[model samples]
Target: MKVSMGVHQLKMEGPYLTALRESNDIREDAAALQARMEEDGYIFIRGFHDRNQVQQARSEILNQLHQSGRLAPDADPEAGLVGPDNKSAFLGGTNTDKPAFLELVNSPRVMNFFTNYLGGAAATYDYKWLRAIATGGSTDAHYDIVYMGRGTPNLYTLWTPVGDTPIEMGTLAILLGSHRWEHVRSTYGQMDVDRDRTEGSFSRDPLELIEKYGGRWATSDFEAGDAIFFGMFTMHSSTVNVTNRIRISCDTRYQLASEPVDGRWIGKKPRAHETALEAPLKTMAEAKKEWGLA
Candidate 1:
């Protein structure tokens, strides 16, 4: 079982940060955006990516893996893919370059919205190279901060699905009110997780807890260009790819106005007493901040 932590530093630095800092038009209404996010735990913007671009990305990854012999034979018998649902094939960050994957990131719409949420005070903290798994029910429920310690007043995640996500199918499902992990920490408690489980595999209790809480599951049906942003501490999991198609997605992480502890990436083990994420917890203070919303 090989465990590889992703690149532990920011990608958008210097000029990029300057550009991000300068681009103020990305967010149309900061106050409204923040309000909606707080109420819904997530905000969806549709038709951000075109259909043809999405198909091209899917083809490029599949072809690369096939030519490299990484794809298996007897995948999809009908489509000439290696196995049913092309079980033998998958590609992620290492196999693709940053420029080619712009459709996944570098969207002004995405960057701008998050920039406002970050108070124009965020820096690119880290990125998870994209990973594609064979089609099946292989996802487990987990939080993003499990790998990176939850820091600052706000830590966020942007989940960009490379294609149309099926309703209640193999799509990212977030527990709506789970954004404030601290609130539920005592209620649900924590568990000891194995490294394998931390990777692409799923955990058994995610579903069990979903049933126990009478909690609702919400799936993202984003167009190729659209992206879903949520708090890093948000409880989320993916549905099994029960359909006969492939599911492709990539994610990025950001920090809002909080300082990174000692300039190091904190892991899930040896949980901390309190994270730097306390600033935003003050409802009145947060609400008082002028988002220029008037």
Candidate 2:
């Protein structure tokens, strides 16, 4: 199959792109699930949640986005048509907590799955991400850790399909077994999204990554109940939305409750990267007067 990934139009018929291994049965076997997570760096579960319930949440979010003037008025809310010239609509850092969205993340199915899979209490970051990706655009390749590894490295991200997200609707793809790649982890994995050069993604071109490094990119057609879970360092990116409808999805982090979570992502109004930067820092000279530490 020919695919559009980043700047390249590459043929996927070769050994380059593969479908993720199925682990929905891991829902019943927690130990097996964690083992899979450790082995593959990701587990894509098809229909892990109830589709009807997921659709309800999808409707609520699309309704809100449409009300916010992000969706096309003439298109059905479920259709996810973007406003004229929207090009892209992202609410990753600035999206606030809402009753519908809050309910979606806090769904019993989600909590139950991780609570058991993690073998302990599970808590998610309050800063949930929602993206209304339009046609011709896709997420740049990056590891989750670069953005949120300040706390427990054990944290995992659950990428949920807000609605029925087919491949044409632009679902995500993971670079096969990236977490265990010592070089990528020791180098790119150690990089921070907030610090250093600050561009979190490793590369936008999938072919270039394979040519320089070496790992296949894997993805699948996603349904509303489908969920993909991966560790903080797992490298993943989205396929372009070839269809006209907006590709709606939400991704949030999960970890054992006892584990420390980054302070910026845990509150009602997440401060995110500018949490401290928005405020001017006190210079050493000024600090001498206040702290007597000069």
Candidate 3:
């Protein structure tokens, strides 16, 4: 199967890309789950959350978009049809404080899973990365550590699709086994998105990494309540949104409560990468050249 990722067309069955392996079978067994994560760099769970709750959260977000004139007036709010404005929205900061959004992220199901997975009490970052991606919008390839590696190396990211997300709608994709690429980790992962004042993404072209290094890109059609969890070093990105409807999803971080938290993502008001915006950013090409990755 051929799919679009960023600006490139990729063959899903060949050496380039493939479907993600689902780990729902071992979800209840922490030891098995941990072993799978350690080997594959991620775990994809089917129906990891309550479907109704996820749909409700999606409805609330769509209604907000409709009220702001971002959704087509003729369409039902739940449809999430983009209006003429067609602007993408990132609700990572204060906007995440909305009641429905908070409930979706802090649901007992997600909390309990993390607590068991981490082998103790688990706490999530207060700052959530909620996005409403419009047509043509997509994220580039990058490691989570570059953006949030200030403290615990054990921190993990849980990505939840707010609704049914087919390939055309642009969903998250992981570069299989990329977490074990020690060379890339020591060089690119060591750099900070905020401190380095760089573009953040390693590459807009997914094929670039595949050609340089060697790993299959894995993704799947995700339904509401489906979730994927990966550690800080996992390399991942999203496919392009080819559809008219918005692609809604959220990225939340988790770690053991006893571990030191990244100060940028916690507290009543997180000072998340605010200082980086003040300076002129360096292009990935420039940054990669400095890191000897080019």
Candidate 4:
């Protein structure tokens, strides 16, 4: 099977792309889980959360969107079809305080998993990156470190699909073993999206990375209870949403509670990266040229 990732068609079985390996079997074994994470850079868990809880969260979120006139008035609220004139389909860093969302993210099931995985109490960022991607919407390839690496290097990102997300609805794809790319870590990984005042994405073209760095892109048909967890340096991007139904998901950060947290995402009102376009933004091309990777 072939899927589209930011205009690039990738075969699901090849050096180009493949299915993510599920680690649910060893979820309770911390040592093995850590070793697997070190080897794969990510752990895709099926049914990590309660399916009913996830569905409730999804319903709440969709209702909020409907009330805001973001969803099509003619469609069922559960369908999550975006309105024709809703230009702001991407709802990142907004609606973090919704009750259902808070419960889902901070639920004992999620928090306990992180705590056990990290071998200590876990702390999650207050800011939740909730996205409601519409048809034609897609995210570019990039490392999470570039956006939130100001604190502990051990920080991990947990991406959860709020609803059933098939390939057509778009879901995150990870570059297998990318966390160990030394050159990239020493160069692109060191970048801070806020400090540099540049676009966060490393490349809009997913094929560029595969040609330069030998690794296959991996993803799966994500269900409501499924989640993917990876460290800061992992490279990932989402497939384009080809269907009319909105693709809802959330990505949140977690790390040992004892470690220093990124100040930008801690407060009741996280002063998330100052994205006001005050100056001419630096392009990833320019950064790559300076780093001699161009």
Candidate 5:
């Protein structure tokens, strides 16, 4: 099934369209920037680092992993494989004074883009869960907030690819404008799974909806420094890393300064919708009150 989008729905508007203009420097105006980003599910920040700078950072992360002896024996010696272990993935900082991983997260270019979206008071930083995937490692469709404690998920995630992410190389893909809060809450409410879903095992069975109606799907070929910014509610997943090469990237989360306290995840019991849908199982009188379908 193919999820299709009408012309207007796929059209870019507000800050998202303006930010892409060559004359505008998004970092200069935080308000307009955030407005645009929020209008769309994502914004791509171009040229955060020079090719050489990215190479240097990549080198440092690889070297650090080697010195720590965390490199898997079966892993390619030159590629600096990050094992499936989350702990070992973070060990990149152990070798160099400021490894590539640290630099990527701490770059002013990155901060400027996020500050506009998350605001000044919002919490911002990288976490240790950024691990390396084995040959076939892949993630199911889910929100990022599930890993972090629940609060109004005002945050967005920035995925920085350290190496070339060709289409076949397994780059990230998103449902594009699927960041609707109403739909999110409604969808989650329909799921039997709740906040307990884990990153490795979380998935929704409505895989067909992605291609239904007029929906838009997009993917990018990321260079070393290009970052893909996406909201937590954005339904996204990726293909398995089938290439012989190892993919290197960093995933960072951002949120509003005053996020609300809600333990619900992307997939929760859809009580409200279920109640309405199950009306057929009830008597006519009860169904009338339940769904107002009388």
Candidate 6:
């Protein structure tokens, strides 16, 4: 199967990415789920959430976007259409702040999934992030740690599709066994987005990733309730959306409540943060002191 990714075409067979293994027994065998996550770097939970709930949240989000004049007036709310005047880059961070979106991310079903899966209570970062990936806009390859490494290193990201997402809609994909790449992890994974002037990505090109990293990229046609959970060090990215309709999804991070939390995303409102490249700048004197150059 062929899929579009940021205007690039990727065949699903061969070096691209094969189907990922599903954890059918995740509910019954927590150890098995952990083992799979440890080895494969991710776990794909099919229909783990209620489809109806996901749709309701999706409707709420689309309605808000439509009201904000971000979505196309003529398009169906469910379609999440954006007008031609809108760039395919349309997405705002505020959607996650909506009550509807909050309910979706903080739903009992999701909390239970983490609590059971982690064998303990899980506290999520209050910032529930939602994205409407317009056509031509896709996430670049990057590990999650660099963006939020200030908190516990054990943090896990839970990603859920707001609506039924087809391959053409550009679902998220994981790089097979990326967490095990000690060379990459020790180097790139150690660089925090807030401290390093980096994009936090290994690469944006899937072909280059496979050629250099020796791992196939894997994704699926996701149903509304389907979710994927991966650790902080795992490498992942999104496929491109070829369709005119915007694809919607939300992600939240969970860690043991006992662990230290990153304060930025957990408050009533996150402080305006510098860009990844801007936050790492240091003056020569400060840098020299840190390096003991003086």
Best by lDDT: 3
TM-scores of the candidates are 0.63, 0.88, 0.97, 0.96, 0.62, 0.89
Model 4: clashing residue pairs?
none
On residues 1-294, what C-alpha lDDT tens digit does candidate 1 reach at each position? 111111111122221110001112333677766776676566555654556565666666655555655445546322323343355333322232534565446546556656777677554443343545454543566665544543453666777676666532356666656665453443221211222122311233443444444344555445566666776456676655554444567666666545653133333232322333333332312221322111
- Tens-digit per-residue lDDT, 1-294, candidate 2: 766678666566467887778986666898898888888999888887778878887888788878887788888877788778766777775354456666767778788888998889998888888777877879888888877878999999989878888877788889886777677677667766555434556676787677766888888888888889899888899888888788878788889999888887888678787423433443323522343322
lDDT of 1 at 291: 21
Clash count, candidate 4:
0
lDDT of 5 by residue, 204-240 (tens): 3223334432234455556776766777666666544
- Where does candidate 3 stray beyond 4 Å? 94-97
Candidate 6 regions with alpha-carbon error over 4 angstroms: 88-97, 275-294
What's the C-alpha lDDT at position 153 in model 3? 94
**Candidate 5 to truth, TM:** 0.62
Q: TM-score of model 4 relative to the true fold? A: 0.96
Model 6 TM-score, 2 decimals: 0.89
Candidate 1: what lDDT?
0.48
Local accuracy of candidate 6 as per-residue lDDT tens digits, 172-259? 9998978998877777777765666555555667777667668888899999889898998888998888787878887788988888
The better candidate by TM-score, 1 or 2, is: 2
Model 3's number of clashes is 0
Ordering by lDDT: 3, 4, 2, 6, 5, 1
